[model samples]
Target chain A: MLERALNGGKLYWTWIGFLLAVFGVGFLFYLQQWNVGLGITGMSRDVSWGFYISQFTFLVGIAASGVMVVLPFYLHDYKAFGRITILGEFLAIPAVIMCVTFIVVDLGQPYRAMNVIFHPSPSSILFYDTIVLNGYLLLNLLVGWTCLHAEKKSIAPPKWVKPFIILSIIWAPSIHTVTAFIYAGIPGKHFWLTAVMAARFLASAFASGPALLLILALIVRKFSKFDPGSEAIQTLGKIVTYCMILNVFLLGLELFTAFYSGIPGHMHAWEYLYAGIDGKGVLVPLMWLSAILAAVSISMLVFPQVRKNETLLAIACVCVFFSLWIDKGFGLVVGGFVPNSFEQVTEYWPTLAEFSIAMGVWALGFLILTVLYKVAVSIKEESGGEAIH
Target chain B: MKIERREFLKLAGLSAIFGLGGTAIAASVQQTPSYIPDPKELTGKRWALVINMDKFKTDADVKRVIEVCHTKHNVPNIPNPKQEVKWIFTEMMENVFPEQQDKYLTEHYKHMPFLTLCNHCANPPCVRVCPTQATFKRKSDGIVMMDMHRCIGCRFCMAGCPYGARSLNWIDPRPYLDPKKINPEFPTRMKGVVEKCTLCYELIAVGKIPACAEASNGAIVFGDLEDPKSEVRKVLAETYTIRRKPELGTRPSVYYVIGGMKDAGKGA
Candidate 1:
């Protein structure tokens, strides 16, 4: 199973090379940041978090999305997902890694990150986030590897792995919830002070996670003789459609509450995000674009004919995934900081260096995803294209 | 192995016991002290600061208070307004007390500047949200405290603070600091940590009043709010003073004495 990743086509090798090169450039920027401090980033005292934290928030959702596959396959006994559950779980491993990396890079003292464990404050949501994230990472790695190894050996997975898989199912949603709590629990940050934050996070994650998975599964099916099966892909598309609809509906609910109440605290953040506050609409275009893409994607997903066509399905998945990415990755975190505590408009935009470092982290995630997917695919291909079940 | 349910349960139970035992041992081995002094001991004192705006005569007098605080605290004098480190500074009355601003107020009252700093809230969200005990409210004095050495600089504390009180050292502050002008006894801060007004804890510890209060020429009053006979208590009892964002329920220890003015903006 390990040796399988060693073999790849010229295109595969080239993709890996491109990712590594991006990683190298990003690493250099990280080194510069480490040397001069976070001053190199566009973050200020007003907007203490910018690109890094937003990415962290988005990736946590991606990490939690693995549960969509695991829950259906294990709980409902959905047979279609058997071939790709390992892929979803493996995807979580790197996604969680990216979440942790983003947090470390955002920290002013990255070296002191161990202090979360060294001196834990249980009251802090970040403390819970650390515990659940690391625990989820381990759970996925153990369950994924055990199942894959068992498949390669042409035997049923050990009975012990069953309990852990169930645990993973329950633990997956907790990661995103805990991450949401990090924002939602803050008092003065009106943008994140909603009770529905965790629900919204989970809904978007369920949609975006499987949508990304569908894209990758399509790529795998196209290039390799092994097919993850149309049934699994279509089932995942249904999950994405339902979750994304819920996500957009929740966004509308947030808008209604903010505007209906007309509370300055609640409405100011929305104003700054959508229409701009004090004549500064830096994120207005991005937010509108996300909303439009979300609407179009949902419409495509809802129609049976559009969803049935694999190409249309792929495009819909891309739209949902990218739309949610903009909503979470750019709008949520930065919008929460603008009209800061003083009700002053201090806009934040990522510098080239900052964006490059982000790219580096993404490339790193892809590099890990490539290796892990290759291994999983090879094991499945060797085991006659399906798990023993 | 095809284990039965009973056998699997037994194995899980054994692992659980060992796991619990391992955690207990590890916890005992790393028995670190609590980050702040016990709240039980804090009942002896609850520090408060009250500023009487009526006593304030000139803008230079306010500047003197700010200057003394910065000099005493050895706060870096970064020339850039965007990156300056402020422990205590003056803010326009309209900006600082937005809710209290009045349209009918005289020009003198309209443009007047008031001193501002951390409220040092009785119930501080910053202390509550800090991952490490880097930001803690002192139980004894009720003053919000920061231990920069322990701060991981995640800025959660900054987010948690409602008043925009905290500032992160975005760059190494030493390069911008004037060594000759800085207090020799007060230590400068390193980059990559959140810092703010500590209410001159060092001065308080030495039985001297805060630098800002000492320089305010009896305008800024400092005493124990819990003490019924203290000057701060007396000022609050006799004067019509207000705290910033009191509706938020942070119970800020700082109070302002506004002279016979009404919030005309609020249909006065």
Candidate 2:
């Protein structure tokens, strides 16, 4: 099946080459970061975490969203998702890989990363996060590979694979939850201190993850023989609509708590992100763009006529993906650090080196994703278009 | 030398097991001796500091305290405020105690500089959040200590701290140090490690106080919080003192004595 990926047309090879080139350039920047230290990035003593960690946070949500498809298909016995469940799992593999890579790149001492394992502190949420993330990655690879292999053989998946599938389903949510706990349980970071953080993370993840899966499903439909079923795509759009609404509602709740309570500590972070504190508003415009996109996406997605229209659905998915990308990937992490512990504002903007390194990690993820999806789609195509499942 | 394949395999497996077991036994037997406290070493149940702001009347007074501690600790003198590293520094009173400030507050209090450093909290969030116990609170005395050698430099401790106390060496700090002024006794830090004031634990081990306290004339008091007779306890009791973000429940060991004028005339 992997050999099918190796035997792609000119366009497929060109795409692979492009991703490799981007990855190679990013790796060069990463090597420089290793030598010069984290100071090469725009992070300061005040805003310690920047683009890399934020990307890690957002990608974890994407990885966890695999469970959205897995649960409905396996537990509820929804036959519509039967063709797309493997796509969800394959997406997870690369998202988790990117999450782990972002973490490694964000570390000041990448060489000492093993210290997290050698001297594990159970009290640390990060320790649990590391365990759950790696565990989720392994689970996805095992389940996705085994199931795809069974499909290739035109047989029911082994009895042994059932328990592993169920475990993977349960393990998926834990990864994003632990990632949220990384910020939520911190002592003085008021923005992340809210109880709704994990919920907000899950909501945005469910919305953005399926939105991406929908876009990919459409691309697969256009490029290959596999359709992923019109019913499955429509159902995914519905899922995205409901989750995006919930995500926006949760943000509204946070805003209410911050403003209504009139606590300076509670309000300051939101003010810094949305309105700016003392005229330092680097994130203000980006946050508003995220808000407007979310509004537009939700409005378009809620209408059944628009969702049924393939072209509108694709546009909505793109809007949801980038909107959440800006919100969770950019605003959330940076917002928590601004008006830094001293009640003094210190804005952060990633340097070109940080952006290049980050772009490299994303390209590496997409490259892996391309290879995995190629194999999965080829197997589906070989089995005479969805009959094997 | 002429053993069969199966026999050779059995011998190799047995030797590997014995080799591992022997190494384990040797390691257990060669364990490092337990630390012995020197007779002259300063011992405390819980170490604490009291910064008497009234005594810090002049700018030079605060500067000297920061200089002495940073010089002793090999803290970098990076020109960029964002990347700068320091063991101790000063902040305006309003910024130091934002919750306590109001428009009508006296100009004397508003403009005053309060010395700041690691609180070495009783409930250190940095220690709790550290994936590796690279930063930990010492059991002998409640001083938060950082093991630079063990830190993976994840910077979780920086986010965990509410005081903005910790700093990561963003670049190799060696270039920032003045070779002529470098203290040969103190180890210089490498890039990609988080460091902060350890309350001069090295000095304390040899029966001396923290560098900041030693240089502050009478403004900074260092002593055991558990000792009722200690200078820190006396100052804290006689004056109205506050810790940074006390509501967060970290129980910071460093206290600021606000509005106390008993030693206001003192100069470094």
Candidate 3:
């Protein structure tokens, strides 16, 4: 079955072909970034972090998506995720790869990324983050591959595997939470300074990330016989609902504190991000659109009729993921920069070179995800494992 | 039920050991700490600013400070204001009397320009939030200084600061200093890092006055708060003065003695 799938043109090459073309185009873009440096991106000194950091931020959520399945399978012993759990773990591999890529490209000296290690400063949250993110990546690859290999041989996983899965379950939240600490730990940027910022980051990540997986699960079901089933998608859907609710609620708390305080230093960030401050603002339209879409998607999740429908669920998932991506990734970072210490606004636009490098990194992730899913689907089909439904 | 007391004790000890062993393998997880400025630095002469808004008036005064410092420090350019990275910027705000802020400032009068720069606070948020210790406070004199090479251009310090004193080099700004001229006193920064006033650290080190003080006609005073006889202490003692954002508790060292703003009273 594995040999047949690998040889079958209709089975997988189409995806491989399409992904390659996109990846090729994105690679060309990255070349321009390599030649010119970050100056090519739409970023300015005022908005030092632009799209690349946003991509890094958004992809961390996607990488953390593996936890949504891991937690249920290990914690609750929900075998429903067994058939598709590998997909989540494999998705994380490329996503983590992309997260690292984005960070490297975003740095002033991409070569010095190793300096983050050679000169480790525990006081720097970024220093600790490098350890957690890479460690989580290795853990996922080992556990997911080891389990899948055992399944191919028709044997139970090693006893050691149990502890690893249990650990990864807790480790998943740690990834997003540490990513949150990256923002929350900043002292004066009032928008990011909130204590709930980490909770909010996880809440939103779990919501949007699982929502994306549900969409992927549905697309797989439609295009291939490897459909994981309605039961799994719906279970994931419920996770999205609970998370999106908490996520949106946290955003509300932020706004409440921002306006209520009346501190210019605090209120100004909100104004610059959503409303434009002192006549210079960039994120207004993108932020507003994301907010509206997120609200609509939340309402759709709440209504059972809409949530249960596969088509509506997929649409809602994609919308919610994009909405949260813009909010968490682009807006959160850029918002921190505006109405700078002097009450002056500076403009930062990502140059084409910057945008291209970002695109290339994401393409690399998609390419890896496509190949991993194909292998998982082939194994599941051959083994006749219980359908996820 | 009373079969073995020794066995019971052994069982208890074994459970405790296993519990500790199990938890040891678990990942060490710690939530990020809440940001509270250390008072240890502030406790000993937490130097602060008190601004006198009355003295600064006229373009000449502003120019005098700019030039005196510009010549002294080789502060590169005067031609293009956009290319200029200011050590100090002057501005004026109408006095908000009955409200005393430890770091607050009155506006720069055409007759009086309120100078603004790094406040060198006891609780420097910029220092605490810097991911890299590129920006730090001096141990001996309590001045905040920046190292350009180490700056990753993350700009978190710029965002963390309440005062808009930090500036980013949006472009390669060095050529404005006249391609031929170079000053070793203040190293020009590469693009993408932040730069700010160092309170003329080199000047103070060399026993020279801060540029702003040298430029002014006795308008600016520089001295040690630790020494009551220092010129600054005498001025701070004789005149009622104000500090910006007294409520935030930054403990700024710059003092202001705005004439009528004493009715404005940051003096207390």
The sequence of per-residue lDDT tens digits that candidate 3 reaches over residues B52-113 is 54555566776677666655544445353333456676744422221232344433322244
DockQ by candidate, in order: 0.50, 0.75, 0.15
Which residue runs does candidate 2 get wrong by more than 4 Å?
A385-389, B1-34, B263-268
Candidate order by decreasing TM-score: 2, 1, 3
Candidate 1: segments with Cα more than 4 A from true spot: B1-44, B80-82, B100-110, B260-268
The DockQ leader among the candidates is: 2
Q: Candidate 1 — what's its lDDT?
A: 0.87
Instruction: Give lDDT per model, in order.
Output: 0.87, 0.91, 0.71
Q: Rank the candidates by DockQ, best first.
A: 2, 1, 3
Of the two candidates 1 and 3, the one with more favorable DockQ, higher being better, is 1
TM-score: which is higher, 2 or 3?
Answer: 2
C-alpha displacement of B109 in model 2, angstroms?
A: 0.9
Return the TM-score for candidate 2, rounded to 2 decimals: 0.95
Angstrom error of the Cα, residue B26, model 1: value is 26
